[model samples]
Target: MGFMSGEELVVTLAPVAVYWVYAGIYEALLQHTTVLDRYRLHSRRDEETKNIASRKDVVRGVLLQQAIQVAISVAVLKLEGRGAAAAAGDGRAAQPEPFLVAAARFGVAMLVLDAWQYFMHRLMHSVPCMYRRFHSWHHRVAAPYAYAAQYGHPVDGVLTETLSGAAAYVASGMTPRAAAAFFAFATVKGVDDHCGVAAPWNPIQAAFRNNAAYHDVHHQRGGGRRNFSQPFFVVWDRLLGTHAPYALRQRDGGGLEVRAFKPDPTR
Candidate 1:
């Protein structure tokens, strides 16, 4: 058997491919044109002046993390004998899953991923050393953009993203193909959350409550201390009292911006 082939390759690389294509589209729209200006959560001035990490640095960090993800995926496939079994023509033909079953698995995966990310992400912030060493790199982008979604310390990425994904897949009992799809969907969601655009017409944005505006709050100065749930539901945040409520208001110039508000004490 070659090092990796068939479903193994797809499972390993599909999410990475999806991440770049989705994020690249946002990069092109945000950087090359003024068309999306009205949808932007922050002004171009904020993106340029407030962000500490350069584009080059963000790209390099994402690439490194992706490489690590791929390596870990390959290792998992080898250990599970999945690649070898497929290559050897094991008699078990791939069976089509029932639609309802597939849906259930997807739902379970989302819940598992959200719970894992919520707790792990919260822990990263709760502990000062972990935040400084692992998570702070991601916070460098005060005015986030699409491609900066995965820009973080590799160790942080492995702990929060890579392992959480694996846990979701294992817990949901999803097939490799389903896991691939889930990961790709997650990549798109993560990129959208950081796109810094709250385009009302975006279906993905409309479908999920934890959209760009919600995540943009976490990237702000004081806002990082709350809203730790990510890329999916806000159940954990709400339950844990970490949900920083925010309102999206029209910017003075054109677009929209997120302003977090304190909840009423009596109400």
Candidate 2:
């Protein structure tokens, strides 16, 4: 009933923690060394010079966004009666849901999140004022790195991330533990999408079609108006004819690069 504790605290903080740890590794390996250079989608030089914002600014922005996310998550837990339920001590042992049921719920949550983000992300690009004032901040990192994944205006983060995540959590009816896992997975996926690596051997990238290469296209100059889906499926972009096809080409400078093809006019 008071400040978040136990499961509630874990649920609210796990995703933020995962984001930092995962992004930190990418920062160290990609930004500070050339060990992963061959797997990179953009050259390290491009990441250093092409990105509009400094690493310090990106870190500050992501920290602020994560703070907002944590606050919203705690508020959601309270609204869902999780805090009070924990306080009242429900003495019964909690039974985990069946694996099939949990998987179904996770699928539903992923769809809901993809739908919410796809629509909202496209809308932000469509509106002149919204694009100029809010979403443009995210676009500042033309060649994105892992830590820049959540760098955006605060209001943009709330609408696109916090609200969408909360919607997914509520709609899927997942347990707090399941929600913690889901949120943590989503955090990792987002970081990977911006990681600037198209490592084919990476299971997460191979498993989801919407990987770093796909997202890298969206960040490019000509591809901005397409491939608006994020972190999961590309169903919306495909169905809506906004999907830009791309090929992963080896850069002349010894890394990989995404060469996005123009969307089909007939579609």
Candidate 1: regions farther than 4 A off? 83-93, 263-267
lDDT of 1 at 57: 100
> Candidate 1: which pairs clash?
none
lDDT of 1: 0.88
**Tens-digit lDDT track of model 1 for 1-267:** 567768889989999999999999998988899989998998989988999999999999999999999998888777766456656776552665789998999999999999999999999999999999999999999999999999999989999999998788778877677778989999999999999999889999999999999988888888866788888999888887778789988999999989997633332
Candidate 2 structure quality by residue, lDDT tens digits, 1-267: 456657888888899899989999988987679888898887767877888889889999999999999998988888987445645765431557789999999999999999999999999999999999999999999998898999999999999999999999999988788889999999999999999888878899999999999999999997779999987999889898999989988889799888999887666
Q: Candidate 2 has which clashing residue pairs, if any?
A: none
Worst 10 residues of 1 by lDDT: 86-95
Each prediction's RMSD over C-alphas, in Å, is: 1.7, 1.6
- Runs in model 2 with CA error above 4 Å? 86-93
